[model samples]
Target: MTSSRQQYIERYAEYAMEQMRRYGIPASITLAQGIIESADGRSPLANSANNHFGVKGTYNGNYVLADDDKPNEKFKKYDNVGQSYEDHSKVLMAQRYQQYVRKLSHDDYKGWAAGIKKGGYASDSNYVSTLVDVIEGAKLQRFDKMVIQQMNAEGKQFGVQSNPLSNNKGTKAKATGMNLPQSSYSMPVQRREFMLITSPYGQREDPINKGKTQIHHGIDIKTNKDNVLATENNGVVVGVDHRTTTGGGKTVTVEYAREDGTKTRVQYMHLSEISVKKGDTVNAGQKLGVSGNTGTRTTGEHLHFGVINVSADNKLQWVNPAAYLAEISQKGNLNIEAQHNGKNILAEYMTAGTKAVNTDEQTPENWMSKLLGSEDAALGIEGGGDKGLLGNLMQMFMTLLMLTIQMENKSKEEKMQAVSDAVINRHIDISSFVPNLKSAVLSINDKGNAVLVVNDGKKEYSHELTNAEKNSISNILQSDSDDTTKRQRIGCIVNAITFSYQASNNYEQIEAQQQSQQQTIQRR
Candidate 1:
């Protein structure tokens, strides 16, 4: 078995790399996804059906029941591995992945992979890392050489076409790889909280000295007139230091550990003043200290809110706090109206700025509203409002759903929890799926999970769920994450998902890419 696995893996490395070049996916990721999904091409799905990618039938269309993808779970079958490769490439080139395409232009694979996961291209969380592993292990540099030769021989010796299918694996060098099995999740965390934007995280002067010689490790967040730096959660004050900062200057570190073992360290860097001391336990609303322009940081007075992952070595791993600070919702996502120049303009998040949304005629405000309820337009749905009365009371109900955005405004930390949950909970607004959503959130538990009391605008749904159903939800939400790479995909199609990939306006992303690359090299 092991020998056979090795044989197929070697074949996959050669095959996937060529496919990546043709499809524009990173060869490394393509190799990795094959290893993980097809079990080194030994699984029944790959062995029998030749459907090595294990794509599924979706709500929109296209499905086939194959051998390995669970009893009822549909999988895409192919005539042979060649066809499978072609399908994979075509899927990636779909309109849903425009941002993915742009990422490729910059050769930023990490950004592209993270963009895939963050864009909900896949429910898998470690989608990026998985790809990274495959790329490295396969030593895919070997595969890149074979590409031009194959292309040169096309129609004569290669007998290949000028254009490959969008999802064709041989075309995408990066799809070479791309997380978790299953889980018994607690109730889905649903949140509705007030959010105020003071300043963005990691905004600073040039981190790198002219793109060479020196690199900035992080961005700075300016604090508005308030001297208060609030907590992301209720925990203990960890440190107050005045020296030894590569970028943060004087810093105040607050470690917030929930009732569960989920510990998050919020570091307020370059603060001029520190009000809290070490070992002092604080609440979520407690003021930690005033923001400042201290240390080696040259930016004006700003609060640097940094999310640090505590390594087992007790070292701090800095992560982007925008994900931890803003109450940005996921999935059913944000119910937002972009107010620009006194007029309402639809906008979408972009790598540079929020670009004007150019969408089809069947948008929510136009057509989709009539097909499904905003509250029930996704997986594990909850219909809002009284069914018969919804039409009669459309004006009143719509007014209230719209009004909730303004009615309850809260701190940044609270918004963080709310948006995090909303993002994880599919395509429903926190408020629309659950009434009293602000109060429904009991607390986030360990393992980054939370329980919620969800009410679809009218009545709360039954809280009871079997272990199997609960596991399904858990598997979907906390699947493996993607790795950070320089060769990225944007607006590329994957499965049926089309997405817009983005990176930091600041250079924090560049640092992140370098850091992750170093880690990958170390593992090798």
Candidate 2:
């Protein structure tokens, strides 16, 4: 079946909203220009060159010969639709469009459109009216509303107070039977099944020095994985200490804001590697580093996790890591299994004073294949489906097409072209939906047929599966460890769909891009 105009808008709405957040461009203006300039995403230039908005001249030493007002004129080409969209945003910041940037708010689509035309973006007499018709008729202004809501929820403006952990404070500390600490709370490392708490946070015999008892301010957690994860939400990396001394070595301290707007610091120490530097923003569950015995005081590979709260009068108090993790663990959700390195690994949430063992899966790779296979069965193609490739690619074209629509202005277009030259030429693969996937669910429909629902945050797309597909998905979900949450199960199904689809349609392109990216890093 042929793609619809509405499908184009829906597919790229998230990307447009993200651009709006990053570049202060109205989502409405971005979407409107995309529709009109790309002929609802069916333009030849868009299809062959990934050049939306008919941007002219040499872009990064790459040029596509296309007929515009004259034959064989130069037009800007992009590697992906996302790059085009980003370039469009940058183009609008040029000298000619600087007035619009200064005068218009990010949400004012009308002002942007008027400013673009008055600023001589296009030679066509009806450019302004055409853009207005597209914006108004499609209710693209609603996207602007979505952008604002997302930003407000994130508390990025207006001095509005925010709490990142409001939804994550799972259970009360008393319920876990571990005496709660006076101030501050969180798990040092999440999914405790893979981690063993070797040392508790209290007075104990020093493992490093023989005999004498010492007051330990931190808990020691041992894990097989080299990487470490953040414990609290809305955290900013405040300090990084790399000294190899008596204290824990290679530490990263993150400052977190509490409900009352006060701040506390969580420290992860004894690391083999660190992923964050000072002044970098971090989120809870973000990978920070690998566990290692880096300090003179440490005996083996383990995480020395600690928390500190400061009073208004400059007093300091240490919080018990063991009790804090136990309390938070009692209220936390079950762990989800994520696919990494072709393995199905589950991050297990631990209860107070309990230890967990690995599941009975003989091999993780075999399990990953079983779960991912279900996705292929549902799509009704081979193990890797081809039925959806054409459609996916077409939609990708439309997406890229809209991204460059705002680049028609002469002065900014030239500037964008120059910048594109500085960055190496690359291409976007439109045949895979892996980048947008959030979660998916597979279940029996009213008619008893297996159906799959894929969520990309903004909307859900559903497809019916074959009988074989239903059985495969059900079996995979049921076979996972008991610690896996329902959300994790759904996530498994969604990832399986994406992995299989991309493998079948765009595997080579994906591999090439990865290789190219690696080379780019090597060059740098």
Candidate 3:
């Protein structure tokens, strides 16, 4: 699959934030500009040379000539994307733009966006609108909130300590009442207090075969409870089986889909009971079943938590669950608005230099209340009726989901156009389904599986296709193969899904294009 705009945003968000913290440029502006200039790091200029910002200068004496330039203008090249980000920041420090750079607040993205255009950074007249469009479409202004949180933590602005999510206090419940088997291993089980890790993921000496090395796919955590809780979110129970005689006795597998549609399958082995069946949608922290020593190959009672990656080819490869957990820990949960303190920061930066209705009460809380209509609305979620923090989090996530769907639909339209052009020019015969394509919808699930939903005027039919099938369809469309009835149907369905998947945006590239179009309009 092509790199989604969201993927690019995520990839560069940290680097941009780091640069913002160091320099005075707004992180949001930097990110929006990066998306606009680099096509979310997919443009030929960015991919070939790592020149994300189109900064024209020598970086360590390396440069590349522009393909479209009449005089073959040299663009700065960097050894890595990080260097490009660093140079992008340094370029703003140049004398021409130094006045705006010095006067503009780091959080004032709108001012910076307007100022950059006014300072003649780009010759385009619609630079302001292009930048604003990107910033609004992707909600890039959230980075300002992130920076404020960092600043709050570092500066102790409000005497606020660590946020709730960052703190581990009282989160781990004691497994004392469950009467789990006692073991010498006393290391802290991740996200669990009383539970202990008896075995870790990696190559270890095999118990079944003495002196031989074997891969331990997951970490073994001992718990006496009947139901095992999920560690991550968006879990769907995919597989469940009873295997009393095998080493992995009575296993339950749950598949999780990341925001980027990548799938991770987590298996819980040696279960005494299974509560969920296949296809049951489960949430994080939900109980699956009881843990026990039910397998024939087990030495003691423990839950073998294994993580697996489902490849595009439908192959299962085991990965270290501990590593996955650690990576996620650093990212933290963005849904917790209180932790990030988004409301206060967003209000302060968004309306910088504006006078408030009540000058005396112009604090962060007051600003949030003024913007959101009430203190409760700012602290809580509007229209969600006070479901508390978790409820507010869910509401925020729903908004994000809605925005994602809209962006994905636009992306799918673009992808369909590209693929349609390719199919038409190649003389591929999909006439049977081409005229009726409007009634059909295609998408790739987080598991990398293709799903085609077809509406035949009266009834809607949904078919799940494998990666191999999708590839076959792609091959038929691209190759000069003779069209059979089956091949034609397969070609249409697969091509639709292929285009949709390719079109799926994390909203980064589409935002870039929005900015690009603005430049085009200005040039005209």
Candidate 4:
């Protein structure tokens, strides 16, 4: 009993070997017994004292310490850590309780699972089940007896070390346990496939944000870009349900077994319709549905692709599919191009390209043929430009040339005939108020001066313009810019009227003063 700890290690060395071969248990169980009983290798009885097992002492009070408990329990202090290991094994093997367990337990995780359950060794109702869970999940059963024997024979040492069971760290080992025999060398990475091309990622605003409450979890797939969806591999449809917010109406979740032997689940959101059911076996390249803007969709059709990864731990992981898709497409907007007039303006690019543009997604060209045709003749003056701005300018120059020819054909008096009945700004319909005004005309001097001619039949009033008026009229006529509005017209007319009225009023006041001065002189 003096070398009790050493004797225990030596005694269980064979039992340890058998358990290791049978259940992939390691040889380090002695280390655990040594550490715990020896109290960090410094217990008095474990050092020079030489009583390692921490056994109890009776009449010999000098070898024992009385631990105060309900009845003051007696604990034997150890002098050597080695003796403690020997005694522990002797106690376990000598006891009748654990004797059957020594031979009955198998190395596979399931046997360990059911065995621990029946043993009543743990307080947890699922104690054995938890071990089995970790064992199966982490592939712990791979440490079977035959595999260990083969590895040992080949001298290919895996994580062959072990520790004693006395350690309270009875939790299941991680997947990185001893690389004994049956373990998977390299686990495959898990993956899943789904179409998420509908909406812009992270652009959930307002209604898609759902009354400022919930967010649009997935994108709305319109009939715009994605006409179909395919499973990346053979898989079962795991889930499908109408979200309070996922689809404008419906959502489908497809799960597949990854090549890495793990599982991946994908979510399809905002579908106009669904074609498959839960538990349906879908293969790669099967059509999920036409992309649609269903629930929570205000605009265009796009698909929202999401990727999910799950571990044997029953936990999930998510990744962004956008970078993946963009990488696959190589920056192409993923739509067909249609050619139009040489200028390649984006017409109906990707169906309803404008209103339905996905957030974060680039825009495609609207190169479709015009569903509504443009105008034909000079649609200004007589009809302006049938061909738009440039055409109108050409038509105006031609009209001016014709008018010059007509003037050359006429005598000087006849040259004035064209102006006696016209208003220069024909669009301003002040006809009923200024009743006698007949027709409008434009009179230009050789000095590049332009005059607006308003002709009444009985009397011809020539309203001449100053340099300021010429500049204002020229500026208004030659304006060519984007984002034009009706307010521009109102402002121009208002400024001209105000300036002219003020100038005329000043001149009339001066004339009135001169008349008053003449009256005062006559009175003097």
Worst 10 residues of 1 by lDDT: 486-495
Best by TM-score: 2
Overall lDDT per candidate, in order of appearance? 0.43, 0.55, 0.55, 0.39
Off by over 4 Å in 1: 1-208, 212-219, 244-246, 311-319, 326-524
Task: Give lDDT tens digits, candidate 3, residues 370-401.
Answer: 22322222121233233321233223322222
Clashing residue pairs in all predictions, respectively, total 96, 9, 4, 65
**Model 1, 298-401: lDDT tens per residue?**
44554555565453444343443433331222212343322211112222222123333344332222322331233221212124334311332332222222
Superior candidate under TM-score, 3 versus 4: 3
How far off is residue 347 in model 1, in Å?
12
User: lDDT of model 3 at residue 473?
Assistant: 55
**Candidate 4 structure lDDT:** 0.39
Clashes of 4: 65
- Kindly list the per-residue Cα lDDT of model 4 for residues 1-524, writing each as its tens digit: 13454444333333333334323433233233333455434566555444444555532344544443435555654322233444444444433524434554334445434543454434568655555543344333433444455445756443322222211111111111111122111101111211212233232335544534222233332223243564354658887765536434466777766435556566766566677888888755576655455665444344455545554554453423332232222222332211112111122112222222232222111111110012211112332323422333333322332333342455432323222111111122222222334633444322323444444453333445565654554454445532132224423443454446556767888999999999999999
How many steric overlaps does candidate 1 have?
96
